[model samples]
Target: MAEHAGAQKGDVICFGHTHKPWHREVEGIHFVNTGSVGRPKDGDWRAGYVILEMSGDQPRVEFVRVEYDLQQVMEAIRQSELPDDFAEYLATGGIPRPVESAADAE
Candidate 1:
């Protein structure tokens, strides 16, 4: 991923599309993924985030998780036209399977 992103040595890259928090250093490049705060898909389920501190020439990364009112979000979803599976996904942190099509089954 770094290769495609043209990341170089000593570069710090931060991204959060996957909703799963992670950090790593590759060939002097630092990569940080600051997971989702509301719709997390990382199974542990609490809101996930990250803190990056730069002291002098060194960088420090900290992952943070916080508790939120899941029931309130679920209730809102229940009242909406969206499918119930959305609420379930928020509770379990597991993505709902895509609905299979008859043509694709072959």
Candidate 2:
């Protein structure tokens, strides 16, 4: 994955997953994950985003957290005719447990 991102001896790379935000240099390349916006299940309530600046000799990384209207999302969900349980989970942050797989039967 790192090679595919064009990361060489001195290149910058940025990627996001796992709902974690970070900024740092690896092997002379800068890598960053902007974190998650919707389900920032992390302890912090603030949603995550990232910014980069290359004007300076060294790249700059900025992480910003902004709050939006969650109720509007709920209201939209209400109008979508989706299942009530789904909406309830969104409003309450109560994730449903996943069903066990046969591989786990051992």
Candidate 3:
């Protein structure tokens, strides 16, 4: 996909929306996925971000993860009238647990 982005050599393209963090270089074009800062779907509950440093014609990229009070966020969602599944998604890092039916328990 980076090749189709019309990036030339030594060009860096940073984007994030999928909530999955990733970085790669294709044909001298640097592609970076900055990940998510709040609702991360990369199997990591922590906040994800990136740091880009450019010095003297060189560019550096750094991926950062931060931990916060997930319980508090989940509690807020639980109290708001949002579906419980939302909290579950945050707790599980986008992997939703299968809801067990009462009959299945028996």
Candidate 4:
């Protein structure tokens, strides 16, 4: 936002790296994060995304969650060389458990 919109008023920014869908306004700037489509980390399962509708002067943001065939996804992964961790992630929407750090090894 700082780079593109420069904190301009009414500026809307969208991103999805966190895979946690959300919509909010901060400092007069609007932000929406369209969560992952194939693998969300919000623990709600199913595919997730956001839909923005500009009906009037204000933009309406809606969070959409769609259900897909989980069995097929698991089967395809099982038949391929993909890591089991990937399949597990698709099966569960929970954020990945943090790994132990070097400090924890001490």
At residue 32, give the lDDT of candidate 4.
Answer: 90
lDDT of 4: 0.79
Which digits, one per residue and each the tens of the lDDT, describe model 3 over residues 41-84? 87898877899987765579889998999999999999998998
Flag the better candidate by lDDT, 1 or 3. 3
The TM-scores, one per candidate, come to: 0.77, 0.58, 0.80, 0.77
Residue 56 displacement in candidate 1 (angstroms): 2.6
The regions of model 2 sitting more than 4 angstroms off are 1-10, 78-106
Report every candidate's CA lDDT: 0.82, 0.67, 0.83, 0.79
Candidate number with greatest lDDT: 3
Kindly report the root-mean-square deviation of model 1 from the true structure over all alpha carbons: 5.0
**Mind sharing the TM-score for model 1?**
0.77
- Candidate 1, 57: how far from true, in Å? 2.8
Instruction: Report the C-alpha displacement of residue 24, candidate 3, in angstroms.
Output: 0.5
Candidate 1 lDDT: 0.82
Error at 28, model 4, angstroms: 1.8
lDDT tens string, model 1, 1-106?
A: 6583464545688888988889887766788999898888778667778999998766899999998888998889999998987888888876665788999898
Model 4 spans with C-alpha error above 4 angstroms = 1-6, 96-106
